[model samples]
Target: MFVTESFNRQLDDLLERICSKLQISSAQHRLAQDRYETIGNWLGARESPLAMFNPVIYPQGSLRIGTTVRPCSGQEYDLDLVCEVQLDWRQVERPVAVLDAVEQRLKKYDTYKTMLERKKRCIRVNYANEFHLDILPACPDPSSGTTCVVVPDRDVRGWKPSNPKGYAAWFESRAKTFEVYLAEHQEPLPSQEPVEMKAPLKRVVQLIKRWRDLKYADDQKIAPISIVLTTLAAEHYGGQQSTSEALAGILAGIVASIPPRNQRLLVLNPKNTKEDLSEKWDENPDAYEAFVSGIIAFHQSWQDIARGRGIPSVSATLRDLFGEDLTKSVVKEQAESIQKARSEQRLHMQKSTGILSGLTTAGSVSVRSNTFYGSQEVLP
Candidate 1:
């Protein structure tokens, strides 16, 4: 495969760019933020019935963890959120009533009334092609202190335990551990770098989600849930420096973590021990099998990607892993970026590993400006 430090780094940067494209745009994020904040204000307003309970609305899922990906189905992006009120779970009039209260308050506003759609767990505000806001109504769980919340689940007509805030904090702690290591090693951490830059772990999660979405586009019933993927990735992550390395390691860890086919998969909520994130797998054994086979194939594809050389070959592999259209666009853009960097006399080739990148590195040489078109296309 002739993989070297420089080659691996180049691959890492390629993956990084792909991850960036898969993410929600900054403007999209801003719009979602504005919409959610306005909804938050309205939900907590004094005129609202639940205002007496002092409701607080905030983001909880992918957006909070920075692993949110753009939708591939020409559908709206999801901005998962929670509206937690200061109602006591013990004295609540009705557990499911909290959901009704939220739905009613949102319905009172004409804008939300038009946008709102009721679900088993949340009230979704669809925003067409942009993004949708899923606001889950919740109340505090006294047994677990402040971080724990009991959210309505209509399937059971009972409150379900969840800790999105706590789970986010845990993910940050895991990812930050690597950032600290990188900083100590004299490398710029993702936080200290450009806003588009993501830590390796987050990038890996983004890629997995993208893969899962595409691979199960028609078979959503068997697709693994975001929480299971995110939790497993975060749990098994060992702070690898590059997205490629982290992806490989995390996949292997998750594969090893799964039990024999006869045994059930138990992915418990990290914040709350009582909650099993993979509970749905128990009811649909085929879903578990699908997850197992899907990840196994994904891991094998990633392994093949490591062996691939050049933009065209790697791009082909990535097309199968992700999709053809997105991969082609990213590949073309990256190739142009490299060409531009070379023309500006800014590209460097690591002498030891022959890695060509815009960034300067030790034991590397600048790619000289050349005019011979036919003979100058070695990298291509």
Candidate 2:
């Protein structure tokens, strides 16, 4: 509503580009479905509880978009088709073993098993084409607290459910609320309301997103892809946005556009690993080195900006911006001075309380030991 015109066009172009690339031709969808259903059938045949394919989570959206928004273009987050399996409809086991077995079973097919591997929580299968499936092994565990999702050998702490249907419902609810909030706070939507809404929303979204990218990268020291998505929900009403939005926003801004120094943290291009990560970093060492320095410098700049803004959470701000030791130190002389003062006060208090007297006061000479002590001692 109140947004600049250029920002609106950019948003439209981005969404259009993303959606166009994601259009599911019937043939392609059918193939994906065949593979998905085949995997499901395989799991069910294993006497595993009935498996269901969730359509909502398939084409990863804005979160994945954020991953690609970095300066180095080819860094892509995986497109995950998360399959939630009801193993007994009560709890899910370490489906890694199942994934292992499934990969083995599918290996002979050769069409589907080349890149399949059991990652932390899922069976990741790479297709001959660029598309991939992150077949997350899940069983409902009430002990998983409110989320009811569990990953074996991994702490379930701070994890949330990503079921497509459930997440879609949640997102729809949030979108409705966000739309309402926008209408109330901003000018009335244009006759072409949908078109009009696109720009401001896009700019704000991107700006907030850029901020999130920064905070997650620089301050939180979180994984790049993680910061991208988490920052999105924090910046916009993505149904799943939680209480952590404020912190997410702060962290995102702090770490925006950071060139990753750690090779382990780099997300290589899915199609060409060497081209995306190794070769680029190796060839342009000077540029990459400059990029890292720039990130740290920008983080410092954000610290000043945040301080100026009077944002709370000092610990978080400090962690993201730069490394510094804020802990107060106790120098020996200072400790001695403090201890002497405390002993004198203690002696004075004891004298006032009518406790044992004729005492050597702290910081006074001890006759027997011939030593100057900082505490009181009875002369008796």
lDDT of each: 0.82, 0.38
How far out, in Å, is residue 320 in model 1?
A: 0.8
Tens digits of per-residue lDDT for model 2 on 11-49? 223333322222344465566567667765565453433
Segments in model 2 whose C-alpha atoms lie over 4 Å from true places: 1-77, 88-95, 101-110, 128-131, 145-147, 153-177, 181-223, 227-380
Model 2 lowest lDDT segment of ten? 1-10
* Per-residue C-alpha lDDT of model 1 across residues 1-380, encoded as one tens digit per residue: 11223546656767887897898877888888899889999999988898999998889989999999999866556889999999878787578898988999999898877888899889999987678889999988868856988898888888889888888898999899667876788655458655554688898899999999999888788989998999999998998987888998999898888788689768988888777889999889999999998898888887887776655656677898878888877766766666667778788888876766677768878888754332323352
Reference-based TM-score of each model? 0.89, 0.40
Prediction 2 global C-alpha lDDT = 0.38
lDDT of 1: 0.82
List candidate 1 stretches off by more than 4 Å: 1-5, 185-194, 309-311, 348-380
Worst lDDT run of 10 residues, candidate 1, spans 371-380
Each candidate's number of clashing pairs is 0, 17
